[model samples]
Target: MAAPLDLDQLQTFVMICDTGSFTRAADEVHRTQSAVSMQMRRLEERIGKSLFEKDGRSNRLTEEGERLLSYARRLLHLNRETLAAFDDRSLEGQIRIGTPDDYADRFLPEIMARFARSNPRVELTVICEPTPGLVEHIKRGNLDLALVTHNDARQSEVVRREPLLWVTSANHATHEREILPMAFGRPNCVWRRSACDVLDRMHRDYRVLFTSFSATVIAAAVLSGLALSVLPECALRPGMRVLGESDGFGLLPDCKIGIMRGHTANSEIVEALARHIAESLDNISVPSAEEAPAFDLAALSAMRGRRHKPANLMPGW
Candidate 1:
């Protein structure tokens, strides 16, 4: 039989595609850039095809690389699941998790569900808070793990870096108004700070029309055309339009979603949960700029027609 493909190399391949650069992929896998490059070269030689091609200063996946991505993700997930199945069942503890409402709604359900299924006795206490507060909670030992948005590259293991978009309801003319009206979370919210800072730097006049800790409430405000808000690409709904420079809104910085752990988070359970979070994020297919038009207002209206109701709000939990 042919020798089995290495899972570690497969993971490196997937990371390279996800991050869009060999350097970023190296940072993610905690390997030197040369090491990652060598590994990929070997992988290509073994498979007898090029996996990547130079696209300017960055790398783009070749056709073969694209086909292998899905298979690699499935293989990694199955490998982890199989290992977890044989893990010691005696591991049990209450794990306190903190995350922003946006991430909670988008990624937490599946993460928590899989964790619960695998470790039935491990109790989960999830807290919904802004990223700053979540970090503080982790530092104060109030949370075992936290998913936060930070601009600092050295903060934690970055799961994803999504472009921050200025979104408004397609039916609403809020973006056309003078002195842009904005809706955002309360103080200490990263998106709120980022929006305000950019507007200030650009000398743009804007007013805070609504403030809510709940993402659903903010979505409702935007959906009703009450105000425009800055959100990550993943948080955008089908019917929401992304504003750009042409739309009179300056570019916003990308939001880095990272996994943070408390000082006391040294248990196997904590590590397992972290792995799950990373894997879940890795599996998400973020659209490339070329694939998505900056302002596709026509499609927005269609998406709005079938928008699903927001998940249950978990404020101050």
Candidate 2:
């Protein structure tokens, strides 16, 4: 009987495909480049097909390799789940987690739900705050783990870089205004700082009409046609429209979301929760420039013409 494929070999293969180079994969797997190459050779020999082909200086996955990628991911995921299920199920401890309101709203629900099922004995305490506050909590050893937005990638294990968007109410002509009115969260918020810095650098005339710690309040302010706000693309709502160059607005800088561990030593439970958060976030797809929708000034103008009266410009706060 033919021998079954080794999980280690499959792991190496997947890493190579993901990293797009044997050298990088070797670094990730803690193996020498030659060792990684030998593993790939043995894997191809067992499968009776070449998994990769040389495309110029880079190696591209073959059709067979492409087919195996999906299976490899599923098999690896299942393997991890099985191992975790058999691990010390009795392990119990408290894990304190911190995150910005935006990320907490988008990702924490599913992450916490899955974690609750897997680690029923583990107690979780989550704190929602701005990125700066979360970072402070982590530094003060008040939090076991934190998810935050930072300009520096070296600050933590970066989960992803999310594009910032200039969002306004779809029903309002706020984008066409000469001096833009904007809403932001707290003064120390990353989004608020980025928005103000970009506007200042661009020499744009803008006014901060509202400041609130609650994302709901900020969203309500935007939806009420009182102001435009800069937000991570994922935080944008269906009723909001993204402004682009055509809308005569300067582009906002992207923000990197990272995972930070508290200064206090992490227990096994804390480490496990951090791993889960990282994996969950890594699985999310960041929108490409081509996929992002641009602002339609013509449409906004057309809608404005049909409006019988101007929108209320008062701050929601």
lDDT top scorer: 1
lDDT of 2 at 75: 73
Give each model a TM-score. Answer: 0.73, 0.76
**Per-residue lDDT for 122-167 in model 2, tens only?**
8989999877788788878899888888666337787766667788
TM-score of model 2 vs. true structure: 0.76
Off by over 4 Å in 2: 1-9, 17-20, 23-51, 61-75, 286-317
- Which lDDT tens digits does candidate 1 get at residues 1-317? 87788889999988876676777778999999899988988888877888777655545677787778778987878776767667885458888888888888778877887777667668989999887788778878888889888666437778777678788887778888878889998876778989999999978889998999888888888888889998886677655677777667777777789998887744677887888788778676544444445445443333333343232121110
Against the true structure, candidate 2 has what lDDT?
0.75
